[model samples]
Target: MSVSGVREAAAIWARAKARRDRDPEPATVEATAPGIRRRLDLPGAKLLLAERGGRPVGFALVAPRARTLELFYLAVDPDAWGSGVGSRLLQDVEQHAREVGREVLELWVINDNERAIGVYERAGWVGTDEVERDPASGRLERRFLRHIG
Candidate 1:
């Protein structure tokens, strides 16, 4: 992802969170873009964007960690929700993991975010017993994992 793409992805992330009513203040790209860029700078990290009509609709960021692929972020524009954009982005993430020789893909989702959790579950990701509190949002998050080869 380029500099501009990171900004766009950040906007989508913020919008998705806001649409779910996750934050009262809602996040801004100015605050989220840096984190996205920092993760993208990591070794073996990949950012996959789903575009429609030459415009970005969703994105997924994954990085290799140990023997698994860690999904750092996945977001779809509110306008594109229920349009299959998120599912396509997830499929791309799984394919990318397979190409990188990583059989396991893992991610953390806020437990209250049922929409996102449902998406992951439909994609065959299983929620594990591991859970943690997000320091930034003070929300509970559960780890989800899937195996693909």
Candidate 2:
């Protein structure tokens, strides 16, 4: 989506985010739209969306983090969770990252989000004990990354 559409895009974000806490500010879709889009469009950033049957089902957002590509955000429609959209997005991004000679695909996940962490691990992502809080939740989280060919 374009920057102008950030407001509309915010609605989907509200639906996509799995609640980590009872925070209301981040959940205010309209307010977070602009900043979220700005962050995604920063230098060396990439955003990919997954659509099928004319509807957006997933999105993957990336940004440069030192020598790595940080997966800043990734979300699949709860209804499409097991339909391979997430995996496809990852593979597509991985290929592009490799073509650009990126050393790794890094991302941070909430410690409580075992599902995503497991998915990444299965995709060859390794875990690091170094943890931090997602500003939105203040929950303990860990970083994961995988090297590409």
Candidate 3:
């Protein structure tokens, strides 16, 4: 990711977090850039950039966490929302998770985010009955996971 991409991600995250008015983990993506980069550089972590016919479009960053692969960020350009970019990115993530021996793939969906919740559930993700308060926002997020062989 370039410095500009990091800036863009931060801008996007700001809008998202502010829209939710969530509790508070570091709201700025740049604050987490170092750590994000660390994980992206890790052996089992994968960063996938979504492109349409060779044009960059979006990004998804995944990391192996113990027995599961964590979907860190799945960002799609606003202009590309209706396309299959997000779906394709997710499928690739699932495939990578399975190849790495992860029986489960996990992601945090912000509570009250009906759209994302619907998409994940329709994609076969189930809630884990766990609520985590983001250190940055203090709002609680429900954990969701999908099991894949």
Candidate 4:
């Protein structure tokens, strides 16, 4: 996915997140678009989309840092849950990190998203248990890390 694909990919992320978030007010496309565009413009930032029968079903956004690759966003369509889309997206992100020589992969998940946390944990992501409030939604989020390369 490229900068031209931001709007579609952002919609996939927003919709999937909305279905899974415990918070009453989920992120809206209007609010997430600008940040998605900014990230798309960043050097070393890559977006990967998963499609089923040519229809977009998931997306992952990885932002490369000095020593780590941040899995900035990963989401699958709610309808595609339990179909391995999330797992494949995460795996692809790790492969990308390895290709870039990143030592680790990092991502933040809302503290209340147990399903997502479980997915990451099963994939060997270890959480430091540190929590921070998201400025946009005031939701508590936890950071997870895993050595990748």
Model 2 spans with C-alpha error above 4 angstroms: 4-9, 18-28
For candidate 4, the TM-score is 0.89
Compute the lDDT for candidate 2.
0.73
> Among these predicted structures, which one has the highest lDDT?
1
Lowest summed-lDDT stretch of 10 residues in model 1?
A: 17-26
| C-alpha lDDT values of all predictions | 0.91, 0.73, 0.73, 0.84
lDDT of 1 at 76: 95
Query: Candidate 2 lDDT, tens digit per residue, 37-134?
Result: 87776887767777889787777777777798888777776677778887888887797687667878888888888777767887788998889977
Q: Residue 19 in candidate 1 has what lDDT?
A: 82
TM-score per candidate: 0.94, 0.83, 0.76, 0.89
Which ten residues in a row are the worst by lDDT in model 4? 21-30
Judge candidate 3 at residue 10 and give its lDDT: 47
Query: How good is model 1 by TM-score?
Result: 0.94
Q: Where in model 1 is the C-alpha error above 4 Å?
A: 22-26
What's the count of clashing pairs in each model shown?
A: 0, 0, 10, 0
The residue-by-residue lDDT of candidate 4 on 48-139, one tens digit each, is 98999988898888889877899888888788998999899888988998888897999989898898998899888999878899998799
- The 10-residue segment of model 2 with minimum total lDDT is 18-27
In Å, residue 32's CA in model 1 sits off its true spot by 1.5
Write the number of the candidate with greater TM-score, choosing between 1 and 4: 1
